[model samples]
Target: MTLYPVEAGNFKLDGGAMFGVVPKSLWNRTNPADSNNMIDIAARCLLIEEGDKLILIDTGMGDKQSEKFFSYYYPWGDHSIDKSLKKYGFHRDEITDLFMTHLHFDHCGGSIQWNKDRTGYEPAFKNARFWSNEEHWLWATQPNEREKASFLKENIIPMEQSGKLHFLEREKDEVFSENKELGFGVLFVDGHTDKQMIPHIDYKGKKLVFMADLLPTAGHIPLPYVMGYDTRPLLTLPEKKKFLETAANDNYYLFLEHDAHNEIITLKHTEKGIRLDKTHTFNEIFN
Candidate 1:
C-alpha cells in the first residue's frame, strides 16, 4: 500500500483556542501567532492508495464558502485540494472513499463544493462513498449553539443528497477493528467531536495513524496540550494520554492535519511524559 500526503491548504485560527489551557508562552514557541493573534495551520489530508481503492481522509476547508465567511479563518497558501491531487497525477474524481474524521468545517468542508451554476452545492468527489459515524453525523447535522458555527450545512448534506453518505456502526462495549478489509480501519474518538473516526492503515509494514484532532500537532503530544475547541476537554485528556502511551510504545507515526510546519511525528515516553522523538516529512515514511 502507498500513502500520500495531500496538501489541501492553510488557514489561520486563534493560537489560544488551538492549544487549550496551555499558556501562550509555551505553544507560541511551536506555533507562532501573527499580529492578529491567529496562527497559521495546515488542512493536510491523507491519501491511501491500496489495490483498486483510493481513499482521502478529511478534505480541507473547501473554497466554496463566501469571502466574508472565509475572512474569519483566513484560508491562505498556494496548495489546494485540486492542486494537491494533481501533484500525484490524480484528480478529485479518482477518490473512491471520503473518510471524514468529523464533520467540522475544516475537516469535511472540501467534501462538497458549490455547483458551477451557483444553483446549489454538489459532491466534490462524485464517485466516492463519504464516511462518518452515525453519532457524529447526527451531532453535526443538528449542532448545538457552541458547535453550530463549525458545522456548516452547505459543507455537509450534499453527500447524503448525492446518495454517497455511509455511517460506520458503533460497537459500544468493544473497540472497532478492521477484521474485514474495506480499504482501512476507523478508530472512533469522541473527545474532540462525537465519534470522530481516525483512520489507521498498514503502509509498507508500518502503522500510520491520521491524527485528525486527537493530536493536532507534535506539541499536543504532551498530556496537557489538548485543544479548547473540544467539547469534552477533560475526556480528551485521558483519550490523548492513552493514545500517546500506546503510540509511543507501538512506534506509530502520527500524521498531523493541522500542524503548519510539522508534517509527521513519532513519540517516545520520557520521565516527564510522552515527547516528540522525531519530526519528518511524509516522504520519509512512504518513499
Candidate 2:
C-alpha cells in the first residue's frame, strides 16, 4: 500500500473562529494571523493506493462556488487536486473510493463539480463510490442552523444523485476494526460533527489517525483550543481529552487536514497535558 498527501488547496479563515475562545496572543504564536486576523488553512486530503483500489479521503473545497460566495472565505493557493494527482501520476477517474470524514464544504466540496453544460452538478470523481455514514448523511442533508452554512447542498447532493453514494454502517463511538478491505479501522466521534469518522490506518507498524476537525492543527493539541465552528464545543472537550490520552499513549501520528505548515504530528504526555512531540512530512514517516 502507498499513501500520498494531496494538496487540494488553501484558504483563509478568521483566527478567532478557528481557535474558539483561545486568545489571539496565544494562537498567534503557532498560526499567526494576517492584518485582517485571518489565518492560513489548507484543504489537505489523503490518497490511499492499495492494489486495485485508490481511495481518496476528503475532497477539498472545489472551485465551483461563485466568486461572491467564495469572497467570504478567501481561497488562495496554487496547489490543486488535479496538480497533486498529476504529481503522483494518478487521475480523478482512477479513484475507486471517496471516503469523506465529514460533509463540511471544505472537506467534501470537491466531491461534486459543475457539468460541461453548466446546467447542473455532477459527481467529481466519476468512477469512485462516495462513502459517507448514514448519520452524517442525514445530519448534513438536514443541517441544523449552526452548521447549515458549512454543509452546502451542491457539494453533497450530487454524489447521491449520481447513484454512487454508499453509507458506512457505524454507530457513534463505534470502531470498525473488522473491516480489513479498507486496511484501516474507523473511529466514530460526534463532538465535532455527528458521527464523524476518523480513520486509524495501520502502516509499517505505526498507527496514523486522520485528525479531521477534531484536531485541526498541532496548536489544537491543547484540550481547550476547540474551534468555534464545532456545534458542541463542550462535548468536544472530553472527546479530545480522551483521544489525546490514547494517541499519546499509543504514539499515534495525526494527519492534520487544516494545518498549513504541519502535515503530521505525534503527541507526548506532558506535565500540562498531551503536547506535540514531533512534526513530520508524509514521506518522513511512510518512506
Candidate 3:
C-alpha cells in the first residue's frame, strides 16, 4: 500500500474557537494567530493506493459554496482534489471508495459538486461508492440545532440521491470495528459528533491513525484544549485521554487532517502526560 498526502486547501479559523477555553497566551505559542486572531488550517486529505483501489479519506471544502459564504473562512491556498490527484497520476473517476471520516462540510464537501447545468448537485466522483455509517447518516440528516451549520444538505444528500451511498455495518454500540471493504479498523467516537469514524491503517509496520476532529492539531495535544465546535466538550476530555494514551503506547503516526503545518505527529508518555514526541511530513516517514 502507498500513501500520499492530498492537500485539498488551506484556510484560517478563529484561534479561540479552534482551541476552546484554552487561553490565547498558552495556545498562541503552539498555533500562533494572525492579526485578525485567525489561525492557519489545512483541509489535508489522505489518498491511499492499494492494489486497484484509490481510497480518499476526506475531501476538503469544495468550491461550490458562494464567495460570500466562503469569505467567512478566509481561504488561502490553490490546492484542489483534481489537481492533487493529477500530481500522483490519477483522476477522480479512478477512485473506487470515498470513505468519509464524518459529514462535516470541510470533510465531505468535495464529494458532491454542481452539475454541468449548474442548476443541481451531483456526485463529484462518478465511480466511487461513498461510505458512511448508519448512525452518522441519521444524525447528520436530522441534525440538532447546534450542529446544523456544520452538516450541510448540499454536501451530503446528493450521494444518497445518486444511489452510490453505502454504510459500514457495525454491531450495536461497537466503538471499534474491522472494516472489510477498506481493509482497516475504524474507531467510532461520539464526542466530536455522532459516530465519527477514525480510520486506523496498518502500514509499513506502523499504525497510522487519521485524526479527524478528535485532535485537530498539535496545539490541542493538552487534554483540556478541545475545540469549541465539538458538541460534547466534557466527553471529549476522556475520549482524547484514552486515544492519546493508546497512541503513545502503540507508537501510532497520527495523520492530522486540519493542522496546516504539521502533517503527522507521534506522542510519548511524558511526566505531563501524552505530549508531542516529534513531527514529520508524509514523505519523511514514507520515503
Candidate 4:
C-alpha cells in the first residue's frame, strides 16, 4: 500500500476561533496571526492506494462557493487536488472510495462540483463511493444552529444525490480493524463533531492517526485548546486528554489536516501532560 499527501489548497481563518478560549499569547507562538488575525490553514487530504482501490480521506473545500462566500475564509494558494493528483500520476476518476472524516465544508466540499451546464451539482469523484457514518450524516444534514454555517448543502447533498454515498456502521468507540483493502482501522470521535471518524492507518510499521478537527494542529496537542466551533467543547477536553495520552504512549504519528506548516507530529508525556515530541514531513516518516 502507498499513501500520498494531497494538497487541496490553503485558506485563512480567525486564530481566535481556531484556538477557542486559549489565549493569543500562547497559540500565536505556534500559529502566528496576520494583521487581520487570520492564521494560515491547509486543506490537506490523504490518498491511500492499495491494490485496486484508491481511497481519498477528506476533499478540501471546493471552489464552488461565491466570491462573497469565500471571502470570509480567504482561500489562498495554487495547490489543488487536481495538481496534487497529477503530481503522483493519478486522476479523480481513479479514486474508488472517498472517506470523509466529517462533513464540514473544508473537509468535504470537494466531494461535489458544479456540473458542466452550471445547472446543478454533481459528484466530484465520479467513481468513488463517498463514506460518512449514519450519525455524522444526520448531524450534518440536520445541523444545529452553531454548526449550520460550516455544513454547506452544496458540498454535501450531491454525494447522496449521485447515488454513491455509503454510511459506515460504527458504534461509539468501535474500531474497524486493519484490512488488506484499506490498511487501517477507524476510530469514531464525537467531541469535534458527532461521530467523526479518525482513520488509524498502518504505514511502514508505524501507526498514523489522521487528526481531523479533533487535533487540528500540533499546537492543539494540549487538552485545553479545543475549537470554539465544536458544539460540545466540554466533551472535547476529556476526549483529547485520553487520546493524547494513548498517542504519546504508543508513539503514534498525527497527520494534521489544517496545519499549514506541519504535516505530521508525535507526542511525548511531558510534565505539563502530553506535548509535541517532534514534527515530520510525510516522506520523513513514511519513506
Provide the overall lDDT of each model, using Cα atoms, as 2-decimal numbers. Answer: 0.87, 0.90, 0.94, 0.90
Candidate 2 vs candidate 3: the TM-score winner is 3
What TM-score would each prediction reach against the true structure?
0.97, 0.97, 0.98, 0.97
Which candidate wins on TM-score?
3
Top model number, lDDT: 3
Total clashes, candidate 1? 0
Q: Which pairs clash inside model 3?
A: none
What lDDT is obtained when candidate 4 is compared to the true structure?
0.90
Candidate 4 lDDT for residue 72: 94
By lDDT, the candidates rank as 3, 2, 4, 1
lDDT of 2 by residue, 60-96 (tens): 9898999997897898879999999999999999999
RMSD of 1: 1.2
Can you give the lDDT of residue 64 in candidate 3? 96
RMSD of 2: 1.2
Error of 1 at 284 (Å): 1.6
If both were scored by TM-score, which would come out higher, candidate 1 or candidate 3? Answer: 3
TM accuracy, model 4 = 0.97
Q: Tell me, what's the RMSD of every candidate?
A: 1.2, 1.2, 0.8, 1.4
